[model samples]
Target: MEVPDLRSLRAADTPVVGGKAAGLGELTAIGLPVPPGVVLPARFLNGNDERALADLLPGLVRERGVRPPFAVRSSALCEDGEHASFAGQFHSELEVDEAGLAGAVVRCARSADAKNVQHYADALGVAPGLSGQHSVSVIVQEQVAADLSGVLFTADPLTGDPDTYVLEVVPGPGSALVGGTTEPLALRLGSDGVVVTTRPDWCDESFEARVLGLCLRLRELGRSVTEHRGSPQDIEFCTTADDTVVPVQARPITSLPALSARSFDLTFTPVCHATSDELGALARLDKVRLRLVAESCGLRVGRAWIIRAQASGSPRQEEPTALPPGLSDAPQISFVLQDPARLGGSIVRRFSAVGSRSHDLRETVQLVGASHDRFALIATEIHDAELSGVARRFGDHVVAEVGFGAFVPKGVVATSQYVCTTDGTIEHTEPVRQERAFLIEQGMPRAVTIGRTPTLTPEQCRMVCQAVEVANQYHTRPSVEFGVERDGSLFLIDFVEDGADDAGPRPEDLGIISSGRLAGRVVRVDDDRALELASLDSHFHTDRPGAAPAAVHDPVIVVAALPYLSLESFIRERDATSLGFVFRNCSYLSHLSIVLRELGVPALVDRQAYDRLRADDHVLLDTADRTVAQVPEAESTP
Candidate 1:
């Protein structure tokens, strides 16, 4: 079939001849400054016609009238699919003289049969044997020396914002421009002029206006095509030093994801090196929930900010205004910590300072401190070491040291509360700091035991009791108990039905009992009974009621610091008098049971139960049943 004239081809011909060829034809028909070219019809390669293509190319070159150099390129019908939209799938031979154009056309035609191009087409669900039917269309145009060239999007490609359009222009040859190797000047067009240019080497005054005018015209063309075809488009254009603008190619934009219609009122105060995964997780959570968590932790949700090490050399010290909807309030901070050793200190200082001042704030500020790149490398090394034996024996909790001076543990934020040191060791001693010790001394109660298990050791019981004691100090609603054998074997066994302190033992510690049986024991105690005696020293302890005649029920579970009270307290204090719970430290569950018994109230000491109670605002009175009140009705009825 004879190839259609450039001036006679309409939008309907785009899919038949590919985006670049169709765009050239449209520009030529519209009287634009497009180079003279001819599209070799797709029907020419209807069969494996190398001889036919070889014969036709020579005649076409002779017919062009001028023996000048020409460009030969592929123009496959399926080159620009709706989704895949292959930008550089086919071959293009530039600077080919008319004598060599025929040979170049044959070579370009064979590139479609190349392994890489075939694989790409296959990946996009294109069938084989289709390439031979897709012939090369030689665009024998007089190549222009482009002083500036670049791409333009009729809409904001990154955000899919309809009201906004994006354009990029670069100074250099058009080859460098299409390759994306050269830095380009970016312009955002909307109600306001949003221009972001980066090339300090090239500066021209008329370049900006020229590019904007080209963009406006391109937008009109794109709108007309989109209106006809029903979709957005991506366009490529070029301008010579003499201000001659030419449309090179145009295709539908295919990279954008579908967005939901929802408005959010949120703010993010970011830390350094935050991963894209972390950002995605944050995006899944409600902004109001995040704000509440930040505030509860004494952080101001939207205010303070810091620059990332990578972005330090960037021209803008701060990011531009929020993009909109999806990421309008994302914190501009990255969460990668330069050094793991300094992370804990930095977090402590920042959190302490923030907690001291903010009263109305109820936002949760996430402190991301892991470098994702380094983390992956270290994780691989650890996995290669076959540390599963140590992990399994020690509860899959082994911390490995990496070459980059970072610790690689199974889960830092997800499983553990304390930060690991650079040497792949937990800074366990740091938790016994003066402030923590002081807090412990003020309000927690010791445990109670009747008969110690002969198989268990004292140190084991102490470790078990320590976990329970910590939970009691931090929460307000339930009773938690850590049991141990008489010989000092530790077991985290029981939790009261309506207890508080929802934060459970870290995932790494799930099976790591502090006993000599696993590696070396980290916990130490002289006697099993003595550890239970220590539980009596906690502030939550009170005497059992009805144990003695004429004893009044005055069960009192001591509250350590009011700051330690979690959201669970508001729910669990329903039946009990929440008005005058004294805040103190060092108490026991037996004492609390005694006090509550005397006061005709039930007391419990179990971390798991407390976690459940906190998570679900209800009480489990027995093994078979549970009691829950509708939250709204419970709050309002009372």
Candidate 2:
């Protein structure tokens, strides 16, 4: 096979013998540093016995009298097309010995028939026969130890900025350099001295200068190719430690678009968690809005508006109300609030409408009003007799509950009132003081006197002491509740009781025996002579079974579960059921309930009762209501 010199094959020869082989042949003829590499000419692809080419490569390497490993690569004529540049479409093998060079060459040639190459050709709209007719030319070059190697762009591929050429150099193997995994030293070069903006720690100033010089030479080569092909060209070149800079490949840079002088300033605050399509829609709408604003003002837009919003406040409250009518849900309101003087007459009018009291009208009005902080009128439900009482309470105070259409000046404030009747049911309140007292008076030894009834048995006292001991031992921080004996010992109660003891008193056989103050607070002992404290809510004498003795103080324990707690496990646990027993003992009818529905169990809360119970701690009993559970005292700390 006769090897053609680089100067003999111009741009036309590249169409015939492929760009890579043509470029190398041209480099050799121009006396470039490219190693002596022979190409397996394009015509060798005809016969089914193409393996014969591989058989010929070994003898050629032997003819060169060098046993060094050779690099076998593919050169396809149609690969670096102006419309479709196939960068990695063909196979290239490295580190092949002289004995192995022939087989590597044939394998590289056969890779033209690989599935990836076929798919790539198909994607370019090239017919199968057209693709099959293209042959691969194998370039066998002597491998060099590359200290610095990378690709150089004649034009800035990123911004298409023509003023400077971008050169990326990696100080390693060329393969790793091209793949972009390693950070390379990047330089922007023009007529001025090389701009060494990004110098890798592995590369020195001398290496950078050499790479810059090589890039300028390659740019000249690309200009020649562009002159011959009538279009800009992309050249791939590499340099080694021995100062060998070889242009391995060249292609037309097809991605260049016409440069535009017209510029736009886009401003947008992206909504959190917005999908790609939603964001696109928002961008389009913003562009339209900006255009409309600009057209109305008859001035080029210098700045665009951007609105940013964040969700705030307690999770229990509803999200901020939606934007009002005549405005999209995403409100883009423009106002001159920067100066107080320019605000009044500067307001621009858009769409406005009036409404009557129909349902649709009411809804539309509400939707519009919700977007503003204050509305013109207000309505509230108040106790009928307390109307005068409330007005008197807020005398001269700047508060109001005015009717619809009642207008007030922008800065003027006023107070208004309305009243209604209430049914004669007393709302239960929290036992705050009692719970506080129980928490304060815990763990002190004090005297106990039994009522006219019999004193509690020793076993019963021991059970109570055991309960208090468990509370004292385990509760370094606040606990739900603690069990205590009259003698000041701690005890723990079993949530699940198998059988009641005949010798010891039942949990309900307990009552307040006597009471006294300790640590600036009051304490009491039960009838079974167990130490107990009262809740801050009104108490109740329930006919419910297993109820504890009536006492001056009833302390309820409150426990809240985290969101991840399994509701099934919570319900199945014995401790959860025992909470009812503790609630009955407390006698206070208001309980604090925290719902962890997200954890699976949807907890029902009595908001009114819970709010009431959270406020106070006095144990005042009333036996009428059974639905409300009592509140507990704050847990005691040792």
Candidate 3:
């Protein structure tokens, strides 16, 4: 057959135009937003067809005003089937003009015999047909410049939930994602709602909202395609600057895992009311007032119920104090705080365990107040609240509590330092995107990327505002620490007695994490976990193996929070290149600091410097000069 316009073709034309083209043809015929294109048959590529198409190729560049700058892609006969995908194994030339179409088509056709194609076919158990024998048609279609592009799986591959779909999106061309240099913003969407698996640094509420809408649309589109194609499909799509989602390709998922779910008891029991005496186990707070204020904003107030030896944590201690009958013995949630009051160098003890099964509860484990120091919020299963001693457990003071709570499992969480005014207006210290955190799964914490993180919704923020107002009533400019759930549920972790000194600008005139002298644009990795930034010199570390590997050569400051052993390569990679580094949050005594000193390139590890810079932002960061200034974008040009 001769070159077939996309709309003129159908599913029956797979032998000539191949699956990718036929699929696009079907989508176009069914009124989808696929860029218009025409396909040259596989016979031409495999040398069984005519060469005269080249003379006609430039004339067919525009299929009715759908002009070049076209994208020429491979659509082999053996590809896009239920058994094999051949994804990224073939060639795709983007942004080609009419004059370049003939050459691009030749390149894509020749790639059918590339070694990578053979290797992929062999791995997939396909018979040796990838040599000079594979049939790969060429598709020249309008290339849509995307604001965001990604891949969407119609079913949850991780949990095997057909009802759930996953979308991974990047800021610019989808090639960046394939390049392994950037992590895409991931979303889990179902009939219920959208859950942001990973939030990209640039992803704010508005960006998230737009993506959610696009995801729902894609879901509808996928359903339509699946109905026609007869299986759950993997779709590659792009959202243009105009917010139009164009489906470039779709194919049936070949090896979707079976449904498997992890069971962990991270649920909370009902609220148990208690008198001020029982609540007094927690330090220095009006528990009765806290309960009223916190519960009003839907925050569970955790209070410990002191026990003497073998006392079961049950009720009979006032209204709404009913205890759970079959509570597990494990501490489902643990927040170990060093009590901000113990400032000087001292022994320092646990803040308190509301649901801890530990026989040795701290002398005073209070859960309410400002905590600027480190704290552990663990979630597992709740058990008995048994304590060995009430007064004489070799203690400074006696305390108890009947409480169990879980924080929003670690991921990309937005933290804001703000002061709530008497009128309930909040002066934000700015929402600082934290580093990759230890997300607890099955009671075990593992360091993961942003995809495991949750975006704080507006409702959650409103509740925080309300909770802060309550704290404001008790203390001057009181701040509240809250654990936000994946579903945007809020829990009042604690009401801080100390937070944001009038919520003013952090004294930038002091405090630097590391010291070096250099200037460059900043590329924020958003993965704040230090152990992960070890190879800052040569590569932009992200999850997943990239389809294309690259090393850093541009003069840019790499920003990350965590630095691990693999980071030593940063020195070698940065040696003669335009690479600088910044520690978003780190300590001077850390290994990353040592690397910073040894790093011949310019480097700064100041939180302020990190906060001042953004992705691709021209900057001049110097420790010796103690300056973090923005350089003009034009100045960064060679």
Candidate 4:
């Protein structure tokens, strides 16, 4: 009795029919081509017996003038909201016969509390069992045998740019688009032009225009449905065998700008907002730093530390806290003012010195990647004078703790800097602008060479751009290390604060060998036998009494003075050990660099810094910009 005719429903009936069914009904009411369907209200499952469900089936069949072969889909109440769309999270069964109809409906209804769905809800900040409105409705629709299907965005949700609309098309049902099994033909349309961002060979001119027209119309319909022309919307559509466009679903885009995979520049820094007058304020900063490092370890494989700091006043004898790995030299940590405005004069006076350093940090918190409607609005408010008041009101700090350091499989060690301005413009260094111009002028050459034999490909460049865009949406500069997997999909493995340090100045006499930003302490490998056995046993007995081998300590550099270290042996040794290496005779394009690229090991060959590096001397190799700094030997205080 609670089953409502889909055609008779409207947007206001969302609680009864669920978001999807109500959306379909709204489309039908608006004269959009939506397949005929019936909605079984979530409440109907509360008391109905199998016999009662079976009895109601006949009426639905009669109403649709069809027998069997129904599409049983989930229309959960929490789905397709203005802020979050639980797309593909719930179950949807197609080609369900009359015998299986009741069972399919039951499964769909039960999926509201499914583990993955609940996990997704948690990411959206929805606590389970907290809302009394938790329920799911089943949608039994007459399936449209579609020849083509796809999704469309009324605006560029990634960048929040309303000037453009995006469309994606596939040959069959839109499931593959969501499943990501196949790359769909993706196009972007603006007032002046329509550009094919990505396309398959099957895309004919006629089909392209048909999809374009449908996207344009659906975008207009989306705005009309929301009654807000300014807001962006996500819409899904399909075309039947007869080529009639059918609008399937529509919802408001509730994603953040920086989290999206759009190409925008961003700059990030590790500045915690707390009053200088608060008790244990400095302790809180250390706690935040430790939490960031610990979270990064749990989330991904990496090491993190505060490599630099800014100070104002001289020493007050305070108890020293234990510094994390890569930050043991806290007392002697360098500082330089990049932006005086970042910390006001009063706050600057609190520190003896202000400093910054190059680092690789990655963040994997839920807030950084989820709905930013709240965080985006409150981020600015948290940094104001009333920081404690705002923190109390929000019950949590505005800045979500993010992970940083060597978390990704591969690192695209870049010296290029990108700045995302408030006006939505991505200003970059002259080199970056030149590179972009080259990409545009040369039309994405099949390959790009950093040193030799093009380790960075054009396809990879695109992936990097995508990662940068997504990172920028977080409203921070994120240094990203990303790569394409064997499956042809791109993944962002590392995201960290972009402390924009000019690589200082390049040494003219320093020979540029292997290209990458790598730093470690030099440990001369005098014996080739020791090199081979390094993989077998990480430990070595030094001639000196009770001296620990540097190899066991991470980030120690293995200086191979010989020119003929076996490439295979070198790789095997590096694979088993955590230490980086230095080569005296290897070229940038040598077999060694290629192997390093495959192994994701950071190294340098034939650098002038090595000439002065004695055994156990710690050095920072800015290889990408051809600079190096010798780290002073300082003991940890605590």
What TM-score does candidate 2 reach? Answer: 0.37
Please identify model 2 stretches exceeding 4 Å from their true place. Answer: 1-8, 48-51, 62-67, 129-134, 196-230, 259-638
- lDDT by residue (343-399, candidate 1, tens digit) is 222211111111121110111111211111111000000001101000110121222
- Write candidate 4's Cα lDDT for 44-158 as tens digits: 8766756777777767766655545677888878788877788888999977888778778888877876789888988888656413345888888777677888887866877
- The segments of candidate 1 whose C-alpha lies over 4 angstroms from its true place after superposition are 14-16, 27-31, 45-67, 131-139, 200-230, 259-638
Query: What's the CA error at residue 368 for candidate 4, in Å?
Result: 33
Error of 4 at 496 (Å): 63
lDDT winner between 3 and 4, please give it.
3
Query: Which ten-residue region of model 4 has the weakest summed lDDT?
Result: 384-393
Residue 566: error of model 4 in Å? 82
Q: Which portions of model 3 show Cα errors greater than 4 Å?
A: 46-54, 62-64, 130-133, 202-205, 258-638
TM-scores of all models? 0.37, 0.37, 0.40, 0.39
User: Cα lDDT of model 4 overall?
Assistant: 0.47
Top-scoring candidate (lDDT): 3
Ten residues in a row with the worst lDDT in model 3?
Answer: 386-395
Cand. 1 Cα-lDDT: 0.38
